[model samples]
Target: MNLNESDMKVQEPRLWSSDGWTARVVKNEDDDGWAVAMTPDGASEPALVGPWTMGRDKKNPKPLDQSAFLTLVKTAREFVRRSEQQLHAALHQSIAVTVGTARVTVCLDITPDEDNPSATLSARDEGDDLLAQVRVPPSFKLSRSSAVAWAEGGFVKPR
Candidate 1:
């Protein structure tokens, strides 16, 4: 093999490749360098929105190319969609335990010993408090009702 005959073009792999996740850079709200947002392929919204975890620097954001962006969008979109779906499935099925300004829904999935189910419910505020926990038959019954009830704190505990 020739050591260095002439100028050569080197290719590279996309950023943040996982089993079902991807990430890329986009224009920041400030409209300066770049910020990263994750979107699942089939979803219309971004799954995670934060300073791009896998970018170049604080000021200079990595270039926004099609290859990387597409992958990122697909992965992120799927993540968002699945998360939403899981939450939806937990509606009336999970258990409910309201606490504080936030509503925590604990969704338990597949298990013989309910003491520790397979998965947990989604949706929580800044503070991790138990708002609602769904643990049986999986339904979205507590979506809004629980929040309203918790806010008022007028309803007595259900027997």
Candidate 2:
């Protein structure tokens, strides 16, 4: 069966919903006040969790409202964005170095895996020609000096 966007049912607001995000009020483990957790779809955990305001009785947590839900969506989206940026910075690093008469870009890309972790250090010329590539340990550090040294030393694996 093929399902289109129009055929999809509109998600109802609840303590937990399956739309792009779900806002749920849960008992705070560290304190007596309740906390609201905003979880993005397909994520294992909530992107944002914070203290929730009390309801009229001053006991039960306030119900989720349109205003609060919109704010939570913005906050959760930003959280996901920042997380992706940090992960990208950790995985891919690059440096520019002069190799003889030509300037080359050296990149260190790390592929993390549970069974086996690996990294590739590659150099490319001005026109994007592959100059050299070497399989290195994931923990190998890449710097301008290191890249220049490797290129000058005949592109051998650096110690």
Name the best candidate (by lDDT): 2
**Model 1 stretches astray by more than 4 angstroms:** 1-34, 38-46, 50-58, 94-158
Model 2 lDDT vs. the true structure?
Answer: 0.83
Clashing pairs in 2: none
Q: After superposition, how far is residue 74 of candidate 2 from its true place, in Å?
A: 1.6
lDDT of 1 at 128: 59
- Model 2 sits at a Cα RMSD from the real structure of 3.2
TM-scores, one per candidate: 0.32, 0.81
- The CA lDDT at 158 in model 2 is 79
Q: What is the C-alpha RMSD of each candidate to the true structure, in Å?
A: 13.9, 3.2
lDDT tens string, model 1, 1-159? 663322332222324433344454566777565567664434565578655433555555655566655655565566767987876654324444556554454334443335643433343333755444433332223445654553355433321
| Candidate 2 lDDT, 1-159, residue by residue in tens | 996433443333336453477778888889878898887766778888988888888877877777777787788789889999999998999998887798999999999999999999999999999989999999999988999999999899877
